[model samples]
Target chain A: MPWRRPRKKVERPIEVTRSIEESLEDAAAGEEEEDSVDLAGLDDATVVEAATGEPEPERGASDLALKLRETLAREPAPARARPRATTYPESGVDLAVDAARGLRLRNPVLTASGTFGQGIEYAELIDVARLGAIVNKGTTPNMRPGNPQYRIAETPSGILNSIGLENPGAVEVARRYGVQWAALGVPVIVNVAGYSVEDYVYVVSEMAGTPGVVAYELNVSCPNVKDGMIFGSDPSLAAELTRAVKAETDLPVIVKLTPNAPDVVAVARACEEAGADGVTAINTVLGMRIDTRRRRPILGTGSGGLSGPAIRPIAVHITYQVAQAVGIPIMGAGGVTSAEDALEFLMAGASAVQVGTATFADPLVPLKVIEGLAAYVREHGLRSIREIVGTALPRMVE
Target chain B: MIIQQGAVTASARIGDLGTVLGVSAPGIAAQARAGQFVHVRPGTSFEPLLRRPYSFNRIRRQEGEIELIVRPLGPGGEWIASRRPGDLLDLLGPLGTAFVIHRSARNLLLVAGGTGIAPMRVLAEQEASRRNVTLLMGGRSVAYLWPSDRLPPSVEYVTTTEDGSFGIGGRVTEALPELLRWADQLCACGPWPMLAAIGRMREEAERAPAAPGRAALLEAQIAVEQHMGCAMGVCRACVVVTSQGNARVCREGPVFPLGDVAFAEGEPATVGLVS
Candidate 1:
């Protein structure tokens, strides 16, 4: 049987490009940096010496400064203007971020549940191990066939889907994917969904000791199921469900909040009060589309959850609100398509961000987000990504 | 399956039928099989959020090229159909199951409706040399039909049009009976209504075990289409009800046994645990 174990950092061949910090130090020491360097604050004498390997001759310092300034102005800022990082990080930079209260992941970018499959499908085309973790399709105690044809409908910039949490059930999921998830070398956070508090406890109990599974994401806000949003919409109900699930397993429990909730911040605060480890700021917003020809709702279900770039603003807003209301880390999920979008969530106080609908268009987006995050860290010269978390949050009044 | 950028080597319009794009993707071309499809990213933008799935219209292995028949149905299709030579396309494929032919079957029959002609054309070219291949295609009008000159010389081509502007005047099912008796095996790919029509024929033939061409109808295989997302078996958006319960069209299918698939009242049956 496959069991969870500590993942060792596999040594990767380092690329020739040095970190920006190193380049900065080398520039001040009169050493030639590999390619790009920032010479913004260095004196004219130092700049001339570095460029021509000889000290500037005795002359009018102002004239020499003007000539040097003209030369510098003619050249482009190669450090900032160079090509964006398109490849994975070579070494020595930490991209780790907290996925939960104590669940530190290797990166802050993860594939949202349902969009990434069992984490094995896209493993063929891109590197799955590069992600912080993969949340499998929402799991229930029993198998579900899911909704009918027209289960998906495209909206303005997103898609409306009522997949109804189609999965092989929790027992089969742990038995089938446990080994594969362990072998894939990525953490698994099972997205648990159900109709009752007992249902949530049962799924967590069943998946308790599954290998490679680091946490449980309670999907209280799935809009496709009958009364699926009941727990998420009510704070007392959300807390009661969270407390019961927390009693069943030692794994971290993250409650996924619904934007449809009348008071999302209260629900998040209640979950945190009930021992929930973290919360996903927002689930898909309830929406629908009409077929002009048929004069009926396009989705099999009259309304489905809307996800994609269309909901990014809503997700970020909810994340910022929930971050202020609770002390638990928030996993921001919506239509996060790029590193900039992910950064929006990180600065808004989300510990990590999940990539969903965007994966449908480009399978490599999760990896690209990771690469972009590392690039962001290097360019800004930040010691770790955590320093930027909540950077944009409103400062608390003393 | 592989995800790679392929350059457009050839592009042409087939009357009012659709545009056939020839892409040079050696990796995908080498791995492609009949009935398999490629999920193509429409453009660099994200407005058209999902990749479009297109069946392989032609697979030229030695030349390291594959072709797709694309109809401009929506924004995504329009962008892909308007591609010019030397344009690069991001493709994720050769994915899903392929149509399987019994080696001993000497007479093979293929059926296509509308853009479903993509895979049928592939099979006709691949099976023509070793078997007696016959192609029966149906379209809305003469302009919507595939050019006969594009197919191999050894294959027998038949046509039908709803408007009676081309070959035998009617849907493909109308001309299907005459050839059913001669065919040892059959394969089809088309819109849901056409596939459901063939499913009906198979059901009727099953009730009469001794009927002419019963074996061919029983062994027939077909490809299906649906509103898809991800096309990587994750979203569960393109599932269809079958004998084994709900199967993803982008994964377990896009190809399945004729009898295993379920249809209701000339349309794909609604799938779920509830009624």
Candidate 2:
């Protein structure tokens, strides 16, 4: 057991390098000159270069782009130089905010479904509401007691958990949290999983009308279950499931893929063609843990999915592949606990990032990652994240 | 709810106590209770990402620090074994509900597992500080029992071990009937089976009248352990069933009145114990 320490008394304004906060006060000093630099319409390489190739800030690489916002200490008249931010709030000291598919976020970081709870409990230790959005733990069709004991097994640098998607089903969830979700200041993405294709469609369709839910993530990669995960691995099955959910609701549907698949692109493409609005790249990598004393598998389910920093590179690879194959935005995940890691995924092709296992280790990982991203962009003189999306894909097969 | 691993103040192998490590935090001693625990923060080890909950064993007034006693289970527990004085560790604190003692209750019977003594030690000390207190401590053997050096001399002590290697063995509950007959209030902390047995003992004793003076007091309180997630109740990993359904052991309580909580037969869950 660990003990506490005296709270550190130091309080300093969070550091900033380059951004609008510094320029806001200068409006009274000069005429309005629009800095409307559009990186869009630029070829993919140029946009990528504009985003990733710009010189990084010298003061702090770990500082989030939002943090580096050098705003004028005093407010000045609004001129053409500063156009009103599109729907998203820019006044926050942290700059992870952006808008996509009608969803507004504080940052580009979130916890993968099943990795974080409803976002209330960690509030005392972590800034839960400050995150881009919180994806509640995966909810199933019926109340699941979950797997037997020893559900989690530690690995060399990761964890294998066969929680079996334990949760209170949809109706009860709506009964318990419908009001709270509506009240939260941030967007709430609910992750849904099921035992059968019909189960998946039902959960999705039900969530479509559920209040407080802005988007739904379909779990297709869980290795702990006997049924739901298999559909995620088979392209045809995934396509059918996606189509079924599409026919039932108009909500933005994000198909969460499994790294266990032989070709993740096949699964991603299938979901896209079937009408998924977007894709969340790479779920946990299938893994196992053993107990020598019992001469048996450590987890009751025999196998679990591996998460944390161990799966980062694989997630990036899958994200890159899927981005090229699909037209909708991609949400990248797996071991992304830092801003640089988020940047890596954005360069790889994901429009956003999720920090999963790192949340357990450090309550502040997501908030820090968001700030870090903004700091990265500002230091390099990039005006918007659109400049860097998919910056790392090769210009050609060269 | 503020959880952060602090540096280790000291680590030692106390005879029979298994291993003892001290984390440097000033707040826990002032705020921690007998049944509540701080989730152990995740260490560099991959086995456990969450903090481990340890019962507060002893608070040395002279040192102005708290101590935790535990047995090594794996790399995670062994990590606790590896700490040296001044080594920082992840600590989340003053967690769970405490053993509730009514002001009217005088006599107290305290039951403990190998090192479940951590938090109970504080209760013992607090009660001993003001009034009379008796402790009925159970262990696997005399060696598995914590030495009295960390405890106050004022605590009236009773001992029992499984092998009868020291005091009366068989089971800790065996010692409880006598204590339950005498104590106005009882507090127990130990492995689930021992706790359940103690729970059973309380049930049997409830059928009989309390020794003359103690009529209004209900049953004893037992600390239930489970897989603790964020210690903040975010994961809902630490759960216990009650008439009201499941409640988080980490957030609702490690200490709960035996009569109020629903009991299920299963293996003991050592959640935040690895922090």
Candidate 3:
């Protein structure tokens, strides 16, 4: 007889088809009287994340995320998040004393002139309704294509872009974005650039009474080809341009300063003195990248502005200095990718923050930063964020 | 077109299909067109941060599988070639301007170089028996040439190889002058040099107006390629110079009338068209 193998039993992987509430019922069925031994050493935070399906809590987050979170938190997001327990007293977060002209933005996270093109591109990514206001791309009197290839360059931490104010011009932008801006449920700020004083007047005047336009950001930092006056580099010229813009349009005027300026504080002071509503700091720092293969300048213009993470330290420094010199609100921008980055600016004395290249990398950066700040605020037992403003400034040694 | 494929759709290879697009999608048989292309995303899940574009070589409608003929130039193309059939691709479209048919013209000529043959095949198939068509195909060698079986049986096929490994030892345009005299309209899509040659020849022929009714040369259109970023007209990265300044290759055209374009050299093939 042939050697016969015993009948084999096939085992299949068990399929767990737990019903909606069956798992709970099973747990209830196993109710025990004796206390269970704690063999698995898990932390409380881990338990909370597992139960809630949330990421594990992070420790030692930079105050930057908190600042961005504070401003983003002010946005009346329908779903309220329970405040976390890590927030501190106003180290740099502030929600009080903010206005962009007549527009009552809770805080000043105004998009920089060229950075925010239109509301539609970032509609899903940003809480457009919650932003203090959305700034339009730098526009001109005539529809211009702006700059050539490589207008925007990616730096280590940010991006350097010389879009040369490429835009649909004031007429087209106003017509296209006017109604959409209003629907954004936020203030619509248009960043206007001009080769001449009339160009500024004409573009602003065209939008003077438009319902959606909450204010005008005078892109005075632009290289003026007409009068050979660099509006941002020269304080007097910046002041003059600001006053001229103020006289021409009823819209609140914001003067954006160039980081390329020798003294950023004086320029901020000048814009504030010129009756401008507020100021935006540090357009991309002029820089260039070399194409190793071609052995020539990578940018067609030979130079471009650098942005991203590399510039945040500089932006915070500038904001801190400018806030000290000017009473007007300071909208700080640079390499802000997280709430922690945004907090640094606030501590430096900026009331609001603008996110630039980070949006390109992660559209959710702003929202995450906002959520992070709220968690921080609540964790620290602070009722409001104003307690943190200017907390990092060095006290006089006298 | 809605293509439901398991995963091979995202595996796109990169061949110099004449133009450059920054962000492209739909790699394998993703619903595409003859002259159309899908934007290839450079990385897995938005990491590389930019999308590349590729031409749709052929479409397998029954299987909802499309083919892309590519030569990998970057990690992205290598990435597409490595994917297995079951991989799901986040593909976009059969986008950009397609070849336009002139019902009036009875004869057609299709000139292709390298992978440019992909889109032209679609037009060739549509016009196969209905009209007279002559396909002038050129490549590096006979083996490197497109499979002749893919062409319509009605088309008179001709091939040229640079190394004399195929039918003729010269460029495709070597046979064009004689053909141009006979073919009513020339719709050539390929390298700028070849199209520019056609442009020059068309210009020379037009200067004389080809003795009255001898089948006037229909306006020639070439499907130029570029580094297109946003398939929509937003980014302005895919702009080619036109007689009317810059025009978007992705939005306004991937195909243009040969006469209207101003070709730029060096970085990549640059096309200028009359917008």
Candidate 4:
């Protein structure tokens, strides 16, 4: 008698088929699961993929009997019933927060300037409408060619960059992105960077009525260009620039502070006194990495701005100090990669958190943060995320 | 620009040149074109942070597989090169512009240096069936040259090693003149110095009344490399100066026309106001 091998288990296939039938029944019964599975509407390739482990190509291996035998031998579980998680907006949690004096956002997570481009670059990979808002690349009065080659270098737990505010100028940006911004569903925050108060005023006046632009975040903290740090480093200049921009546009003006400043809290206080709606706690720290073999700096510009997890603590500290010094809301930035990190800023007295360098590592981080914040609200039995703001601040009056 | 999770199906060590990994990514493979690259996450976490970009060495649409030549340069590259069969890779790609071969061209020349052979090899395989193809490559030594047996048999392979351990003694440029004479079009991908050398040739050709391969040199296209961040157009890193002003290597390029690119002393010219 010929030796015969035992038939492979068909348990997974049966489970997949059973799951499909269960989903169909649930849909027919008008169950509340919004993402119901409808096999009938699926394409033939998808149906084949559901039955088989992989999609069958149109050519080569199209023999019917071979496909059936292969499908049977493979453990196909394409239709497994996964635990359904509620979407962020419908999670019955209040995540609304005032990012600026007049900028009311549905959530407290925003994309940082210089990292999110014009918000259109990532629209293909993610749903931009889910974010609280998006801050576009820092725009200048005139088009900048940007820095030289080797604009980026990897540090220990961060990255150093010297991209010198490369943009198509303020007028061009507003003209090119105005219509798309209106359709993106997410509010737009224009990041204004310039060499003088006149430049800032020029950019603001040009972008005054652009669609979807809810506010202006003054980028006074760029570390890669000559005189870029002038306004951010000097409290008087920052306040002056803030007042000038607020005069030009009716939109809320939020000043972005730099960690390189001698007194970051003083800058925040000055901006607040100058009628600014809010302030971003911190921008990238100035840092450098030298190439041993080349005997020179790694970046095209010797000293570049450092960002990522390495600067998170510094940002939180600045946020805490600035919150105490000023009455306006603080938009914390620098190296916020996860929900826990965002919560750190929130508890430290920041009204909203900006996901920056981390977006380069993972594009879905902002969405994850929104979901995680909602989960936190549900877990803590809190009515709104705002209830936790400044919870970690010292209760004792100085 | 879809982020697809690819499974490793095959891995081979190509002498001392590099390690080649065959990945099954149907979505990326189907839409991939010559000169396009995939940004691969080094690991599941963000330790290495930014993703490493790798050009496709082979795109087999029928098999739903793409091949990459990964040379372990640092921790991130080592992690990617160490992946074995069944290992999953998160790839964001088929990104950037591709080399466009004019329909009139019957003779095509592809020049490569170092690991730049990734895209050059792709062009050879893609154009070999319909046209006469020649691949000219150079490396420091014989160990760095791609194995001719692995390439399409119809592709004419010529190489040079600095130490004279391979076919030709000097650099790829030493053999480029002969190939340029017989070619109607030229495409190169390599380090800054090699590309800058080609840029000089293009300048000379355009200046002279009638130089050999003048039209081809003027129309040559080259893919460049730079220290990149976000591979997406967001970060503004990896920018090179061009006749059209600043262009992002991740968005506008990784591929550019020979005459359009600006070079300064064997490197991409610095943009913005120099200190």
The count of backbone overlaps in candidate 3 is 54
* Candidate number achieving the greatest lDDT relative to the actual structure: 1
For model 1, how does the per-residue alpha-carbon lDDT over A1-398 read when each residue is reduced to its tens digit?
01112222221112323333333343233222323243555666765443322356785679776755543332212122122322346133466667788676767888898899889877656656557789989999898878777889887788999888888998999899987776565678999998888788889989987867888999887433446557898898899889999999877899999999999999999999999999997789999899999998888777899999999999999999998898999999999999999999999999999999999998878878887888898999987788899999999999
The DockQ-derived docking category for candidate 2 is acceptable
Order of quality (TM-score):
1, 4, 2, 3
When sorted by lDDT, best at the front, the candidate numbers are 1, 4, 2, 3
- Stretches of model 2 off by over 4 angstroms after superposition: A1-106, A204-211, A222-229, B5-7, B10-12, B27-30, B42-48, B59-64, B203-218, B240-244, B260-275
Q: lDDT (CA) for every model shown?
A: 0.83, 0.65, 0.61, 0.82
Question: If you superpose only chain B onto the true chain B, what TM-score does each candidate give?
Answer: 0.98, 0.87, 0.81, 0.98
Name the candidate, 2 or 3, with the larger lDDT value: 2
| Superior candidate under DockQ, 2 versus 3 | 2
> After superposing candidate 1, which stretches have Cα over 4 Å from the reference?
A1-87, A222-229, B273-275
* lDDT, model 4, position A382: 86
Off by over 4 Å in 4: A1-91, A222-229, A396-398
Per-residue accuracy of model 2 over A302-323 as CA lDDT, tens digit each: 7778888788899999999887
Q: What is the lDDT of residue A75 in candidate 1?
A: 23
